[model samples]
Every structure is written in C-alpha cells, then in structure tokens.
Target: MQEPSDVLVLAERHGDVLTLTLNRPDQFNALSEAMLDALQAQFDGCRDDTGLRVVVLAARGRAFCAGHDLKQMRTHEGDADYYRDLFARCGRLMQSIVGCPVPVIARVHGTATAAGCQLVASCDLAVAADTARFAVSGINVGLFCSTPAVALTRNVSLKNAFEMLVTGQFISAAQAVERGLVNHAVPDDQLDQAVSGLVDAIVAKSPLAVRIGKAMVYRQLGMPLPQAYEYAAGVMAENMLTDDVSEGIDAFMQKRPAQFRGK
Candidate 1:
C-alpha cells in the first residue's frame, strides 16, 4: 500500500541509499502514529529492493525526535489496552530497522529523547553532530523508559543504560559516543558530509557481504561465545558460497577493484 503524499516521513532515494527524513519539525519530529506508520512503510518498501544497499535515518528541524506524541497518547490514556497496543506498534517499528536486510544508520542532528533515543540505539550505526543530545527521559514524566531500555541496553553497558533511564539527564553527543550509543560525533558543520561519506563507503562494498555481516553481528550478540562462533562460522561458509565472494577473491588475485553484483 502507498502512503499519502504528505507523509510525516519523507523518503529520498539517492543512488543506492534511501534517506528517510522525519518531518514535523514544529513538533520536534515526534513519532506520532502517522509518523510511525510512515517509517514502517518505508522500511517495508526497502526490504524487497535488491538495488537498495543502505538507509540513512535522519530528521529535519531542531530536534531529531522527541518520542511519542504526548498529546496523542494522553488522548487515549487511562485505557490499558490502548497503551499496550500503542507500545507494541512502536516496538514493531523499531524492530523493522534492525530486521531490514540493508544497514540502517542514524543521522542524528539534535536531541533524541525517550523512544527517540531508542530509535538511535536500534540503528546498526549512528553518527551525530556535536550539537546533538540524547536521553531516555520518560522518567521525568513519572514513566520509566522501559521500551527504550530494550534497545539502549543492547548498545551500551548495563550501568550506563540504567543511569540514562533513571536520571532523565541529557548527554552530549560526545558522551553518546563514549557510552556506545552512537559510533562517533563530529562538528555540526560536518554532520551531513560525515553521514554521506559513511554511506558512500558502505554502499561501495559488496551489498551481499554487508547485508549478511550486519544481520549476523546483531544475532550473535545475544548468544554465548562458543555458540556465537558456531553460528558465525556457518554464516561465513554460506557467504563464501556466494558469487560476490568469488568475484572479490578473483579481483584481489587480478589486482583490480571488485565489481560485485551482490550475488
């Protein structure tokens, strides 16, 4: 199904990378129901496209994202089932970013708080501007950032994740890098160039290798060391069977650049 033309999430296809820009700057790009649906739709669209190699999740305006639309949630508040369903929907949206075959990189320009922070944590990688800030700050409003914690803890240490969840304190982009929430942070002026450079470098690689590696890394993180290696060895064996692997080896032998079909 096609989303409306006036989607809260604006998608731009530039060569092999799809940049999904979160609109609603006036609202700090809050993940309203419409925004969540739009984001999920774009992810779904990318899943079957063999030509697509990466996704750059970005947002416009002052804040990257401010979490769920408070006004919308409060409208349906006091209804247990409504809250449950809403959270479940949000979880699915976040999962799609991880589940997508292609790598997803967060192009964080400003504050990403609560569920917004979860969005950053959920991406395969993130690059933030120096002006950006992050927090799992639902606690400030008397609600613990339980769902955000799911993704946050996966990307960071237990103690670090817990402190952010409980303190409602916003951390600088540099601190985000140190805590492992983001890969790195650069000057605000360099943010766009940094994201573009990273994406360009990634899409130039064998898409098949990138796809398999990104997925395996996330999966193995949950397993015991021995089991993880076992699982990884199997993945490598399968990857080696691909035509891209053979092409890469041949190119290396020939002293030429690889032209991968991602086969």
Candidate 2:
C-alpha cells in the first residue's frame, strides 16, 4: 500500500485491489482543479495495469463530496475560460472512470451532491452507507448541474432524475438504489466490509473477462439493441479466445476453482 501524502489524492493498493481516497476532508472532498488532476492522473497512470482487478473510489470526511469548489470558483467568477476548462476537466475525469477496464466501485458515505453525485453515478458499481445522501443540487445555487446531469440521467430514471435536478432535493442511499444510482445501501459501520465483499466477488473471476465485460457493457450502452448485440457478440467471440476462458471452462469441468493470471 502506498503511503498517504499531503496531496489531494491518496492511492493505496491491497493485492489486486486499488483504493483511491479523496483526501481533502476539510473541504468535503470538493472537486477542485487539483482533485480533478489527481483523479485523472491516477486513472491515466493505471490504464495499462491489467494486474489490478478492482478499483474502489472512496473518500474521507463528513461528506463524500460536496461538488465543485464553489469558493474556489468564486475566485475566477468572470473568467469564462477557467470555468469552461474546469468543467471540461471534470468531465474527462468522469469519462475515465467509465472507460477504465477494471470495475470501479464507489464506497459512499454522507452526502454526495452535485458533481459528487455524478461521481457516484460515474462508477461501474456503488456501495453506499444507509445514511448516505445524494443529489444534483447545483440548481439551488442558480447554476444548474448540467455537467453532472450527463451521468445522472444515464443512471436514474427521467422523472426521478429530473425531479432531483430541478428541485435540488437530496435522496437517501436506499432511494438512490431504488432509482439506480447505487447498487446497495448498508449500515454505516458495515461500509468497508460491504465494499470489500463486492471487491472479493469481482477479483474471484478471471480478471481479463471482467475487464472485457466492463468495456463491452459501457461501449454498448449508447448503441441500438441490434448494434449492441452485434458488438457484444464480437466481444464474446474475442473473449472466448483468451486463455482464461479455456482455463475457466476446464476448471469448472474439473470441479475446482480456476487459476487465473489475467492472461
């Protein structure tokens, strides 16, 4: 595991599981420029590391993330370029999470509002504490959560998602799961254990298959049903050629656990 630094992002690895914690607890892990860079750089740096099977996006603080740094944004209030570039950077970071080959799980606690909720939505799967809350709340400040909406709308139903966007209302973690924002909501004390259970399940399979499946699912999301099926079929064919698939099938036949080196 890597030692925690004074920097905005903290990275730690436990075997095949990598955990990235948003370290700015005082600011509620607001998405400052430094935070965005830290997240993007980590994802970009780890893009080729196939040995990693699961990435857990966790955070420290009373709130998971309070969204963009409004106080910081005020410093450049009239600078259109700064605002545009800032949001664009944030968008790229979110996309990186979606595009990553390994599955990313958001371990959420407390409030995840505005861009923060988008962060949760950006992950492949999320395990949130029962007390955690979520919202696309930029509307309350008269600046609608447009950037966050891209991910929000994709995860949640139109009516429910729109209500939260327009009203700036927060939803409980259970409600978030009901609306497709999170996979499960467990007790606060069980947060770490719950997330680890998910990680364990993910790492137990062929890492390559999980990676391929992650990429295929996200890529096919925007395609029409016929096109999606065609794409998946091609992917299935390609996946079938991997050594892990053969080993996995043989192991099942032998009635024993498969040995996978992510080959």
Candidate 3:
C-alpha cells in the first residue's frame, strides 16, 4: 500500500536506456493503483526523451506481475465506479506502452498473469526466462479477464487467446513464444543477457528511424490491408526524408559504419 512515489515502480537509467522495474515482489509485483500510476508516470517521462533508445519493463520479485491487487479490489467490493476507473486507468497505461516512441521490451522472469499478461502483450517486444509462465486467469475467480483479452487477442490467435481466457490455464514460456506473446525465451540465468542483446541492437539503430518504425507498425495494425499499405508507404516516404535515412543509405553505399544523428 505504499505511495506511487514510494518505489512501487523503480526507474533506473543506464545511458540511453531506461529500465522500469515493478518493485512489489512481496505482492508478486501486483499492479496496485499506486503501481499503475507510477508506471504511467514513468512512461510519460519517456515520451519526450529524444536520446532514450529503449525501455525495459521488468520486475524484481519471483513473479513479474500478478495482475491487479486483488486484496485492494476486494476491499472496495461492490464499488462499480471504482472498478470502472481502475480498469480505465490500467487501459491507459497499456496504451502508453504501445504508443511509446522507443521500443518497450518486457523482461519477464516469472509468471505474468491477467492484466500482467496484458502488459507483456502491449510491449513492442518481450523476452522471458524459459521457466516463466503466463495466463489470463481472472476466470478462475469468476471474473473474466475482459480487458486483458484486448491485448491477448492482438498478440496471439483468437482461438489461443480465447482458450487462455476461458480456461485460466498457465502456459510455459516456450508456449508463450510459440503463440507470439514473447519474442524469445531463454534459460533463467540468461534472461538479462537476452534482454541486453535486444537493447544493444536497438541502441545501435538510428533513434528517429526506430521511433518512426515503432509508431508506424502499431498504427497500421488496425488498418485495412490496402489502407495499411497506403499509410506505411507514406510513413516510409516521410522517413526517407530524414537525415538519418540519408546517412544510412550513404553509409551502405560507401561500405562504412552509419553515423546517424537521429534527425
């Protein structure tokens, strides 16, 4: 029940990368109201960080996140207004991750269930430990994970997403990767290394190109096939006008390392 500023989420900066760790290990890093607020604030801060190349959403405890703080929810019991606000706030947080200019990568070590799974799905990329597990298990408690389903369905096939929602069954990290919930699943000890690899690759790219590409990819996902192509073509043309793209092309032609200013 700590305040949002009391380290419900910890923001650590290393060069151009920001690592935001869920700090509620004792509660399995549950997304309490404070935690959600803290996470949103951190992502908001990233919005204007032009030098930032990547963001890693990680957790400190045995579980990555155990969805919402059920104890906190139970305390409010039949407060429909509170529930609506809570879910809306959470939805905004998830959207912020998607709308991030730089890629948001989830470094998942343990279980990520319910809304926690939604968090992973919302990230641009995710790398999980081989021992990690995932589920949208709200149904087990007689509450369907309706909000989580929005993200889950986007990341995986509808059938698989529906099965997870209805069955409330846990899937292994390997299964998660197979279903496209995560990019890679490595041994537990290699989790950090795996995440570092992704971070390094992204940091080496032109920041502007990465930003444009991330935004374009998400924006086009909901478009019709023809409209998506039309939109992407326009975005690509716009990207071609950037100084970074010019540098990239010239470097390729000259067979030299590209020095992108991210312009």
lDDT (tens digit, per residue) of candidate 1 on 135-194: 999999999999999999999999999999999999999999999999989999999899
Better of 2 and 3 by lDDT: 3
Q: What's the best-to-worst order under lDDT?
A: 3, 2, 1
Candidate 3 lDDT over 127-214, as tens digits, reads 9999999999999999999999999999999999999999999999999999999999999999999999999999889999999999
Of 1 and 3, which scores higher on TM-score?
3
- The TM-score, computed over Cα atoms with residue i paired to residue i, of candidate 3 is 0.97
What 10-residue stretch in candidate 3 is worst by lDDT?
A: 1-10
* Model 2: how far residue 75 lies from native, Å: 0.9
Give stretches of model 2 more than 4 Å off.
Answer: 1-5
Q: What are the TM-scores, per candidate, against the unseen true structure?
A: 0.96, 0.97, 0.97
On lDDT, the leading prediction is 3
Off by over 4 Å in 3: 1-5
